[model samples]
Target chain A: MSRTIAVVAAGAMGAAVGARLAARGARVVTSLDGRSEASIVRARAAGMIGVGDAELAGAEIFLSIVPPDKAVGLATRMAAAIAAARTRPVYVDLNAVSPATAREVGAIVAAAGATFVDGGIFGAPPQREGKGPAFHLCGPVGDCAAILAGHGLDAKVLEGGVGAASALKMAYAGITKGLTALGAGMILAATRHGVGGALLDELGASQPELLARLAKGIPDMLPKAYRWVPEMREIAATIGEDRPESAVYTAMAEFYAAVAADHAGEERETALLMRFFAGRG
Target chain B: MSRTIAVVAAGAMGAAVGARLAARGARVVTSLDGRSEASIVRARAAGMIGVGDAELAGAEIFLSIVPPDKAVGLATRMAAAIAAARTRPVYVDLNAVSPATAREVGAIVAAAGATFVDGGIFGAPPQREGKGPAFHLCGPVGDCAAILAGHGLDAKVLEGGVGAASALKMAYAGITKGLTALGAGMILAATRHGVGGALLDELGASQPELLARLAKGIPDMLPKAYRWVPEMREIAATIGEDRPESAVYTAMAEFYAAVAADHAGEERETALLMRFFAGRG
Candidate 1:
């Protein structure tokens, strides 16, 4: 039997996940309003169908991928939608929000007599045709593993209820992305001194492996950093409830957001950042 | 014939270097006035002979290892001593001073017709017997390699003249010691936020190797960082001449000096810094 998968507030990642499921012959329905034109175009390009509230009345699985700041509000609206539905769908709050928010969303879905699963995506949306990144899912969904596996989505179930998945995401992003920022800063400082070459030579001499990794890693990641800023903020806010010290990522989000905003006016900011990372600026 | 080695302004490192040569059977003479009691005791324990200007007249090698602030003054005094010596000696300036100051010392030695070698010690003085660290030397003196080899010191002769050795030292220290300061700040911030445990757990889970190195490195180095602050300042001054942007290290020196000052009165600062590094603060 075909399963109905409803993706709320469909954006790049939401569209990607929906398209991947739809391609596998599942009924993938995405909420159409309150999204950017780019998001709508991306959803259409990814083969996800935009549906009204009436068309989403029979969804068997509800996957919420709205912005983290709007996670609770979306959950409230989705709870009302599910209440009016002919059948209650299993609610999976996949938004990058704190455990407190997730728990509130869980309560909303539970009050509507629907099952809740907490899910967090760990990588970028699948860009090429027919490829998907890791989608880590956790909670007490009776058939989450089988359902996700059947559709070829890599899903892992962790023990700590609503927050563990977000915690893992926050921690991983903090190190990988945080080091990227540090590497960029150092490279810029070196270039400004006109001793970038000398610094790299010394780094190669002393810490060859790390220097090589940093050289390769920094430049390659700069182009995509702008897209990750908001996601990082979402993860930071979600995990910060339990791990308040992760506020560094909140600062990092601001740092990357500034770059992203500047990128909107002059895409050259990313280029400049990359140049600095390569020790050429 | 055995060569005589005279160390001017014998402080901790100067006394150690002189004593190391003496231990290897070189005739070592060190000036003792205005030195700390601990330094004098260390020199006595290491079998270095305390000598006046007349007694240093016959030495074949003169090493200047005074503080950075005293380098020029000591260089002038050593120039007078070298002029009065019966035979010209190879003069090595190993003080942490700007490249310009090093050149000035070089001029002083040249005025006395003595060969000048600019050198920088890369590591701490030997805490135990017969375990001195490496020293990098470069200058007009082509016989520096032979001189150091004869005295059983691990000295590498780099290519550039008076400033290259100091440049290399500054660049290397900038990364290693700069990272040390950064890690110190991050760990302190983490502990202050009451999520030190979580940060440690995350670091262990994500970057075990780096965290392990930081754990071992920070605590062992913090107590000794006070001594390195002035050396860092000297290196900054040297590198900042050709590269005025190396002022970062001067700032770092001030930061380390502040940390040292804070730790001097309160045992808690050192203990807290160590705990933060070990991820248990």
Candidate 2:
């Protein structure tokens, strides 16, 4: 059966995912209002039909895909559209936000007579790398991943419902992206001491694996760090206020923000890290 | 002209450096006062002459090598000996203390009419590593590196005076050891999210070098972490407050303290990290 799906905001992951479903013969629709020309083009190219609120609520499912900061606002919009049209579509949130945010979004949609499924995308979109994205799903309808798998997504239903999928994503990103900050901090600190070469050499000799990871990861993080700040904040909020581990993620948020700061506020650590790589290259 | 040297508290680094000088025919005298039996054995094995206060003051050079916490106390003792005998020895403090602490020690020694040189040791004692103990020396008499270089030590004299040598050590250690704490924090956090193996796999795939570093460094840090606590404190003090970078070193100190704490405290982080390695092996 063809699934009427509304994929909101056709960004990198969203566009690719929308395309995957459209190609699988699902009736994929999207709202590109107030979107950039680039985003509109992406949505059109992905075969996602442009829609107003009335058309949006006609879909069997509404997938929320946006930045961490925008997740709540987008879910609220979907809830209103569903309420106005007197239709109850399953709304799945796939944003990189905290569990608390997910629960809040779940309530917003539920109050609007819409079914809510919590989702956390583990890998890249299916259209990217020509592979199935690992859609870790939780909540009552969390097995929505199974439905997603029909379009070739690698769906995994977590036994722990509701916040499970979001928790998984937050924790995973906290480690992967968090590591880049750690590597950068240490490398620049070593450079300050003039033992930059010595430390790198020792790591190369004794911790060769770590040396390789830093070489790749730190450089990769430089351009994308701006986008990671809010995600780190979400990770911090998800972990809550009490645990000491909360400090680690919160510190990462500050680290990324510093890296993204302007030239006058140019982070000493960031400058040194850039210099280290520039010298190496 | 052969120089007379007094090496106080012949521990790992002290005994090794003293032996290097003694083997080259320098008169290396030491005091085992209030030292452990192990330390006495190490001092004797290094062929150092046991000395009282009068003999200590007679030496042309006195090297104070101890833990970061003990650096100031040892310097105070050296100052007293110089004051009591009314004789001056060029006192070199080579502990892994903060620059501020080093300056305080330098002042204590210099007040008694003894010349003070600041020193930072980069590598382990030759007894452990067999070579390449880059003794970075600073201060007005920093050329004191020339004296130690004769005994086959790899000594480098920086252009900067006082504080510089200690600053180098603090900054260097802040990164090397700090990175270990960061890695452990992330790895254990990932474990809490039930994605420990997943993170390890992802790291192995994308950050092979980092994966390798975490494998070795985290495990190696276990027993020695208890010792690293004070060094982290010194690094934090050296970086001081009002800078974002200082937080990294401070967090590392807390991380080490948690690891050194007992099991009842349930250092979930420490256990996960240890388990990761134990399972790997």
Top TM-score prediction, candidate number:
2
The residue-by-residue lDDT of candidate 1 on A36-123, one tens digit each, is: 8988887787677888865664688888887666778877777776777788888888766555667888898789777888777755
- Model 1 Cα lDDT, one tens digit per residue, B1-281: 66788887667777778777887788888877777798789788877888887567558877777766677787777777778877978778776666667788889878977888887666667554654666767777677667777787877676567765555555556556665654554565444434456556556754676677668767766776786688667655654434322444555576677667767767665777777665565
DockQ of each: 0.11, 0.25
Candidate 2 — which pairs collide? A209-B209, A209-B210, A210-B209, A210-B210, B139-B162
| Clashing pairs for predicted structure model 1, backbone only | A98-A238
Off by over 4 Å in 2: A1-31, A37-65, A82-94, A106-165, A182-223, A238-240, A263-273, B1-31, B36-65, B82-92, B113-115, B121-135, B140-154, B187-208, B263-272
**Per-residue accuracy of model 2 over A166-224 as CA lDDT, tens digit each:** 87678667666766776676566556555565456545654455567677778667766
> How much is the lDDT of residue B43 in candidate 1?
80
| Chain A fold similarity by TM-score, each prediction | 0.81, 0.87
